[model samples]
Target: MNLAHAAPAAVDEGMTCTVADGWWSLDPERPSQPEPVKVVKLKSLTTGEPGVWVQPARGKLTDQQMHIALRRLSDCH
Candidate 1:
């Protein structure tokens, strides 16, 4: 699946998700903290014209982190 550019969904509500071990951690108390990866999916809220929305997420993830996550997800397919 080409996630780089996907057909935008509608402008509805968004959501959040976490990817375990997505980021590096050092705190022993929170060894599994990894990082909080937010996943947003836009849904059309209006009618007519297929809603062209943007679903983006940002957390403790950097460009490299995001690339790695996307690569990992792609590898699953």
Candidate 2:
């Protein structure tokens, strides 16, 4: 939750995240599109680390969109 030192550009390969709340609108600039999902980093099943990854929630996103969201979330903190 305290991602003050989290890097926004970190790789999300070995990371896992959970949606903290419902999906939110991305930016007000584009009202037509739904908001990106909000999520919190969860413990990595591979590395056993926690709070190291943060990215937009997945599931609804396509492969490309999920990739992009993962990258964006990496920079969230």
Candidate 3:
């Protein structure tokens, strides 16, 4: 696991996960970012099943943050 980097939780901004735990940018310095939402990812890299992507990201996400999160589910690895 990696410490989620300094980035914005904006879909169009960047998804610099290289390899990530989940989609929410966990950088505490970035309070302007959308809260991390707990969601079952359509793909889980570990179990190959859906669940909150731990080993991954932790959060306080919301519906408004969904756009930034959609990509997290598409990760088929």
Q: Give the TM-score of candidate 1.
A: 0.26
Q: Give per-residue CA lDDT, model 1, range 1-73, as digits (tens).
A: 8434332232232333334454354455675553443333333334432222222234333332222222222
**Better model by lDDT, 2 or 3?**
2
Task: Give the per-residue Cα lDDT of candidate 3 at 25.
Answer: 55
Better of 2 and 3 by TM-score: 2
Estimate TM-scores for all models. 0.26, 0.22, 0.19
Instruction: Using TM-score, give the best candidate's number.
Output: 1
Angstrom error at residue 68, model 2: 10
- Give the number of colliding residue pairs in candidate 3: 6
Model 3 lDDT tens row, 1-77: 97344432332222323224333556766644433343333232353332233223344443332323243433232
Worst 10 residues of 3 by lDDT: 10-19
Estimate every model's Cα lDDT from 0 to 1: 0.33, 0.36, 0.35
Candidates 1 and 2 compared by TM-score, better number: 1
Clashes of 2: 6
* lDDT value, candidate 3, whole model: 0.35
